[model samples]
Target: MKVDRGLLEKINFDKGNGLVPVVVQDVETRDVLMVAYANREAVEKTVETGYAHYFSRSRNELWMKGKTSGYIQKVKKILIDCDEDTLLYLVEQTGVACHTGNWSCFYRTLAEGDGNEIL
Candidate 1:
């Protein structure tokens, strides 16, 4: 689902203090890559550029993924959750998605669900 600029109107940025969580996934592998925050401008830039851009809470500025690292993520689709508060970005990852040189940021596992676990 490629998003148009109009889709931005449906996002609930106010809920997250003018930011929204974006879950990035590998379009080919369907693997979760990274999670980042985005403000309205970031989202607009993403839609305009066809690349992943995010708002850095720590830096207090907008950043385009891979701008410095060259591990760019080419966005294929943008999906909004039912609540229109969160977003999922499916992208074609150029290289490792993690700054630690890992394929994904979620490499550590604190707990795993067993097959018999209840909901």
Candidate 2:
């Protein structure tokens, strides 16, 4: 889907101190890849480039996924939550989504199952 650049204005960035949480999911598998934050500029860049761009809270800057690791996330659709305070990104993931070489950042189970099992 073509993202409307004007959608940026609807995001409630101020609710999160100039950033909104973005949930990244695999388009086909429906597996949630990761959760990141995006500021206005990051969201705009993602819309402009058709790739996932997030604001790194630690780095304090905008960064495109896979800019160095070659695990780029090609955004297929962007959805805003009911309150417009959060975002969901359906994407085509190129490689492992986690830096630890896991398919997803949520590999480990935290509930009643084996904690080491990859979900």
Candidate 3:
């Protein structure tokens, strides 16, 4: 699916520092890769470039996936929830999604007894 400026403008970005949370997932495996935030400009850039772009709160700038690490996330589809406050990015990710070099950011599993198991 394609996104346009019109659609992006409709999103309810009224919550949380003028940024919307986006869940990034793998298209084939259906595994959640990571979560990030995108401001209006980031969304625009993502659609325009056909790649994932996010607003880095820490660095205070716009960043595209794989810019430094070469872990590009090619957006397959962008889904919006009913509230339009959240987004889901279905992407074909290249290399590791996590900066820690894991396949996904959700690499730890919580078991009954164990605190956290690193997968």
Q: How many residue pairs clash in each candidate?
A: 0, 0, 0
Q: Comparing 2 and 3 by lDDT, which wins?
A: 2
Superior by lDDT: candidate 1 or candidate 2: 1
TM-score of each: 0.91, 0.89, 0.87
Q: Which digits, one per residue and each the tens of the lDDT, describe model 3 over residues 1-119?
A: 46565667788885658899999999999999999999989988898898999999899899999998999999999988988899999999999999998999999988455657765
Poorly placed runs, candidate 2 (over 4 Å): 113-119
The digit string of per-residue lDDT tens for model 1 on 27-101 reads: 999999999999999999999899999999999999999999999999999999999999999999999999999
Candidate 3 or 1, higher lDDT: 1
- Candidate 2 lDDT score at position 110: 75
The candidates, ranked best first by lDDT, are 1, 2, 3
Candidate topping TM-score: 1
TM-score of 1: 0.91
Name the candidate, 2 or 3, with the larger TM-score value.
2
10 residues in a row with least lDDT, candidate 2: 1-10
Q: Judged by lDDT, which candidate is best?
A: 1
